[model samples]
Target: MPLSSAPISAPIARQGDGADPYAWLQARDEAEVLDYLKAENAWQEQQLADQAGLRETLFQEIKARILETDLSLPSPWGPYLYYTRTTAGDEYPRHYRCPRPVDGSHEADEAREQLLLDPNELADGGFLSLGAFSISPDHQRLAYSLDTSGEEVYRLFVKDLDSGQIHSLPFEDCDGSMTWANDSQTLFFAELDDTHRPYKLYRHRLGEEAAHEVFCEPDGRFFLSCLRSSSERQLILQLGSKTTGEVWVLDAEQPQQPFTCLAPRVEGHEYDVDHGLLEGVWTWFIRSNQDGINFALYHAPQTDHSVPTRADWQPLVAHSDTVMLDGVTFNARAITLSLREGGLPVIEVRPQGLPAYRVQLPDAAYSLYVQDSLEFDSDRIRLRYQSLNRPAQVRQLLLDSGEQRVLKQTPVLGEFDADAYVSQRLWATAADGTQVPISLVMRRDRQGLPAPLYLYGYGAYGASLDPWFSHARLSLLDRGVAFAIAHVRGGGELGEAWYRAGKQEHKHNTFDDFIACAEHLIAQGVTRAEQLVISGGSAGGLLIGAVLNQRPELFKAAIAEVPFVDVLNTMLDPDLPLTVTEYDEWGNPQEPEVHARIKGYAPYENVRAQAYPATLVIAGYNDSRVQYWEAAKWVAKLRTHKTDDNLLLLKTELDAGHGGMSGRYQGLRDVALEYGFVFKVLGLAL
Candidate 1:
């Protein structure tokens, strides 16, 4: 069933004609509209009930399915130890202490069996849920932060491992990032006010009579610029201003003294400060409107009294074909550079005194993330790799010796056998000839007779959703439905070049990319227009809304989660926490050109009476990032404008923030709800 380019219905230029798409919709005055919404809501509630029932049955089925595979699963989790009280296998990894093998066996299952957390016989029992923890220089005491309530405020608590005694600092709110003072007698941490402003540095001594504020930045909007010295006696400050930032150096002992500015604020240039290995040597990455790219500067390695403002700073690298350095890791002899070159990742390990060595990973898919794991030392790096069907792989790479070992591999997906799973990378040219990357995944057993397909895309910011494997995604893979990702512009998948192609004025590329992906899927016998489903969350949800308006007949259903649909209006309101910070990301909507572009594509504002697909819009009640009302209004309008019979479901979570749940079973239940919808649409069993 190939789809043709011809319009499915006569084009009625106006939004609400008598033949208006929403002619059948029950308005607020109409009892049917309220009843219709009520009916759909009840149906969804029943679907949730069915999903819960299936979960109990599926858990056993999936457990058997997963264990039947040949892959090695990592004990299903890691260990957690806090002083004498140790507990591993909490619901979330961040909540518990990850236990390591005492003998460094690195066998997760064996280590789990050996490590034990004994229930204590004491009445006044307390457990330390480790947050950002650091060991003192002498290793006698350990300082860690833990969240007490709604806020992620760290309360500094010190534990004397030998005496099994814990002492609390005077401060109620402490910084997650804190380092011990040189003398080890004083502890330093930062604090933010109620307005979510950056931390002001404070110091606490073991026997101090009073807690002292060591330093504070003047503006509430600005953040702390404190960087500890090699001796920890002095602090380097990088004061952040609205437009730019300035660098300063201050003595720790002089609590209220003015800071000496090392680098004056550069107009239109965004600067970042990095403390170097040597004293007085700091690095700055500066991005400016004039330069059109970023540049790096290395300050003098040591403090020279005679030449305090020494221009001994050298230019290590300048903006070129590379978009910008994503991250930089420093070792004793070299600095490992991570940059996006033409949207692909390139890692360069340049020795300070020696030549640089470049290692390039294959570029067909995306790199989900590349982080230097603390488990390994300077010369060795642990990297996690992910792709469309390839579950994540953690590998350790040695820079000097050029040796690499696979530390861990995601369990082989039992639901999907590589031989039976088919995937392909296709490209579609937009109106501007920019080719969009589209990935499609299908089960070999699934026949191509208009089966339901689930497609996804995210084309905002330079955030690239690298192709990676996920075992959880197997829920969809096990079904006959196909899974897909649309690598549109605005994402860093191809790097800055691709991102620039889809942002602001050129934002149409994102919509076009999504539409193109859908068309390609239908054309390739994967699915028919009516059998396809598309989903995106946040900015990606914005994409879903745009395409639905343009081609509603193309999809069977849509899931827009925590979507940013009220783009045009939200951008104008600076009262939103991230709106001002996002001006550079999503253009200022006040600008004439930007205003017109956003108005044209803004999802909520552009709703029309058209034959639309069934839609499910989800939001979080406490979501400060994307307001709940945005989805509320969009659903309201969609109900009013739809031409034909279609279902629209709005689910709002009152329990959690941006991420839904804290418990493992709760999250699994959430996953089951979404997957159940797809299965029900595809006519699978409850």
Candidate 2:
């Protein structure tokens, strides 16, 4: 591997107004900015040139563990059973369908498969993401959205399954979300503004020349989304901000009628509604957080075609201080409540009039995600379960008996053995005496007490970072590397209170909590400071930057992927896509107090002239969520300020966006590159 970097260029200054010297880098059309990015890319490639063999070895090791030609477990929907399959050398999965058994049974043995959609065909050797995949209620038509430029804007297309014919809408900035009315001829879709916010809702008739705007959320703080209720009786529209929301519903059968408000917007109150006869009445079952930090379940009658507020809601499940009611799903036979208790995921089932029971998984620390029940009236519910050392399994849970049968368990090929790994839960006390949870996994054959460990964290947006199994992670584990995830505050794992404690004015808690976790690992003999590596992406990348600035001596190296480091500048620019929408989460930086708080720890604003650790920064040229310039500008500032001969490299993906490289094979290559970086810095052999 290349030893260290040579001198790099300083950031380009924006001539006049702004406080940022690298503000000019955000100008996409500037040749000078492009040249700078290209130069950095060239430098990064040159630095890693000697690791080509190691990269390939890691890539092949990961590939060897995956079953190349495999098909997903078939799911029955209407008259068909749907599944996706990958060929030995295909870049993407091919979706296929077959008719279910004639006697209304979920049998696929006699079914003949029919090819429907192949992303490989649509991608044409470039990036392609399916934003929306909706089949009409009548099951006669299909509407799908595609974004091939990695820019996040998608175009909608409709297909006639019977005739195998297709046509596209004229929209270029569609939000890639659409729902069909009961009539099947009418479809509702959200439209994205120039800032990439889904601000307007539109209605289109199957054969119409144009779609007309039906509703527009003028407030940049809220985004509009719509979906047909499971009852298939109403089309529900929600306008949601980070902390406040409003709900509206229209009769699915009456497509031209205006949507009636279910609840008016109230600050500090967030709730979601669904159409169901939960109490043997046509009611709206709501998962709301009005009286408690952890949400509760309530049901309100559809009273005389009039809007009902919180006063009309009757509690079905009272809010509990220990349990966070994350979501509620209803069907004829059951009402499922997704919850998080004691920092772990739980699935609760309430059969019509029967007692509630939890669907238990075997693992001590694993993630449980409930899938949408394709057959809503059926007695069985489907869910997926996995952990850091376990491959995911799709299971069919029998609601009546509380027994689950595995429909399909993801296969890990070659010499993979689940019993050869150990997954453990550890706790680290934060500066404020709060115990942060850490999920860790390593090989059972390890001979050393302090192994080379990789610690990952993300503490923002109430988004939990689950300890998921990675086929590529085995490449590190087999070589005696351990991986752990710090479940710090700002994540939903421990409930709303945990999330609130790590966001806005309390954002510093996130960084401090992460540092505590790193120190705890060393103190417990899990890993030595020099053998430890830290990493996070996006907001988590912000965590990496802040902690590194505060205690650069705590880690051997770091990786920031498509990081959101220029927080103060980006959050202050209200014109940015997610800036205004995220006010409740990050606080409005325009306010004096909020501005000062953000500026205090915003990574780009606080870079100091000190010895820094070896770092690898990844960026995407077309990322709409976190702009590419954030990474570029931060790297430029770091290079100019840091007084170290350590490795600092920035690699930009020219063809992809926020999620980095697309396509399965290409994604593996990306992981290989990252693994190579870790190996190089830690001085590990391939």
Candidate maximizing lDDT: 2
**Location of the lowest summed lDDT over 10 successive residues in candidate 2:** 1-10
What number of clashing residue pairs does each candidate have, in the order they appear?
14, 0
> How high is the CA lDDT of each candidate model?
0.61, 0.87
What is candidate 1's lDDT per residue for 567-648, written digit by digit as tens? Answer: 8777887766456556666778889988887889999879999888878777654555676557655776787678877656
- Where is model 2 more than 4 Å wrong at Cα? 1-18, 103-111
Measured over all alpha carbons after superposition, the RMSD of each candidate to the real structure, in angstroms, is 8.6, 2.7
Query: lDDT score of model 1?
Result: 0.61
lDDT of 1 at 379: 51
Clashes of 2: 0
